[model samples]
Target: MADFSPPDDNKRTGQRGAEKSGRVADFRYRPPSQSKPQKCGTGSSAKKRGGGKTSIPSPKPQGSAPSHHHRKQAYAALDLGTNNCRLLIARPSGENFTVIDAFSRVVKLGEGLAMSGKLSDDAMDRTLGALKVCAEKLRRRNVHLARSVATEACRRAANGPAFIEHVREETGIVLDIISAEEEARLAVLGCHILLEGGEGPAVIFDIGGGSTELILVEPGGKVPRILDWQSVPWGVVSLTDTVGRCTGSRDERLARYADMRRVVSESFAPFAERIAPRAECEEEIRLLGTSGTVTTLASLHLELPHYDRREVDGLIVRSQAMRDISERLSGMSLEERSQLPCIGNDRADLVVAGCAILDSILDIWPSERLGVADRGIREGILRSLMAADAEGERHRREIRGA
Candidate 1:
């Protein structure tokens, strides 16, 4: 299946004034202007300056919408990773959801942390600022329930708890630094809908800015049992920084890509070996990829002059096509890549590193076609929240009836 792209028809309605309590009241705010949030420390100063003056409107609660009498309950999820801080608010409609509003910003929370093993002051400031914005959005939407998580950057940082406290104080958002196991599970959950009909075991890989997560699943099972999982410390941002300093010729660049492939393969070897035997003999062994790399490749394969979520999500790219795209990306200079519609200036430099990581996963799995998923941790968090709420409601009704 192709990557998943939630429709963008969710419109904002309601008032835009501060409540009598001096807090932003219930309002339906629109999605942030950028598709992905800016990474921390990079352009945060400008954003902070501009964000201060930006208008934040409010939205009516679900049941209050006049036209939609049977309005579905709303839920919200937030994911703060090494590189990005994202939030999604949605209203469930049957099995799916209509995203009411979404926000994403690249905070690069893990920036320089790989080398220093600590979250920098500037990075924390940037991330906190973004979180503050998210908190306001949640308040405006009156998000009844939400879950916010921090990933590798926080997990590895020495002052992670202190950082979380700062977030709570500044944004009124609690940040949970999830374990690697939970990270793998959430990744699989995000991709579960796409793997419904796949044969044999399906492998899902997510290459993030600070880490990579791989989850192997046997299809058609109650909660696809995780066959094997692994989290590699290296991600696009770190790998690119390492490679950029090497100073190589064209041949060296290719060689560096090869080296990257080897590094990832080595990290994934044990898990890959366990799954490879089954994958080879099975007809349904397939790869499902989530993250910026695979999506960018899908966009490039479609020859999109610009990044279009509708065109790239759930689109299948053959192994050869993947290679072709990787090679084309490797050959381009940062300036050249920045010009590509799918790879903007912000991602142009890191895209190749992401491609390298992806190539390694593909090489290890050797799947005929890769399934794409745009959803990830945020979706998983939302699903969990909704389910918990339903369970709670059911319990309350049962007690009342009794």
Candidate 2:
């Protein structure tokens, strides 16, 4: 594994902030772009849109037996969300998957969409650029089967279908606009690997750029029974836009955080009620959090002065440590936060809002320790594809034997 360091600079000039703000503002009211029609589902079209060459270089030859034989073939998954676009290419190794290639960029695909009910041109362009890179990587890896999904932003946007059409036309990547229920299910599937040989009921929460998903499960089952789940619209970006404008004193910011927490708690009330019926009798309830917010917090708790996925992933953080980290972050200005190795200029301002949302979720659930998960939707998609492939292989073998 390679060492990961935070970006060197965190200071954003007022001008830069204004520029980003302007982009956001433009997305809020601008009309969709009128471009040439795209041909859907052709491999050649995808290759052209992604660029002439592949994004990831081919793997080097090994001295002995080919690792490709011992290890299962590579599988790919892409998740395009309201705030970020990400790709993961991996192969199954026994019970878990080893990542062969991965890419992620924050594009804010849903930026200002809440107000306009449509994806802004600037946001669409940024998202498309990220997808192009992902497509190239997939091609380079020679990934035979993969699934790409788009969440909240596309689901909410009035022009989302057009946007999807454009993506197929340009990238040849069909973006499945997943429903909230499906989103929750995929999150649980990705986190299931973490539950192996563990005890008690577990609660999984995934906080994304646009929405938050919560799931409750009990032991004694191969798959965790979904006791209850909820998808809350309040996320880091949305909350920050609401709470960032009310800055005054430290006390005021604290009050604002409290207000944000109240709102999240209220949104989670129905789910809370559904779980409360069984939660009391269940022994040893555990909390698991999957998203950038939790991972960033884990990095800060380690005080590494850099972000290393290996160290942060699957680590456990105590409630007090989480609280301390949140307080430290709240005290720092956006520029100061940008300087932190775990948080860079891209996430400085938005991270505080994420922290607030996580804190609220913690208060509602009140678990002592939280299991941090770097994997989420992409992993879930890969697992589903792999399972289908395995089943197909089994059927073929059975037919041959017969």
- Which parts of model 2 are misplaced by more than 4 Å? 1-72, 196-198, 243-248, 277-279
Against the true structure, what is each candidate's TM-score?
0.80, 0.80
TM-score of model 1 relative to the true fold?
0.80
Separately for all candidates shown, the number of backbone clashes (residues 3 or more apart, or on different chains) is 18, 0
lDDT of 1 by residue, 325-391 (tens): 8887776767777888878877877888888888888877788777666777787776666555555
**On a 0 to 100 scale, what is the lDDT of residue 126 in model 1?**
84
lDDT of each: 0.67, 0.68
Supply candidate 2's per-residue lDDT for 47: 8
Model 2 is weakest, by summed lDDT over 10 consecutive residues, at 20-29
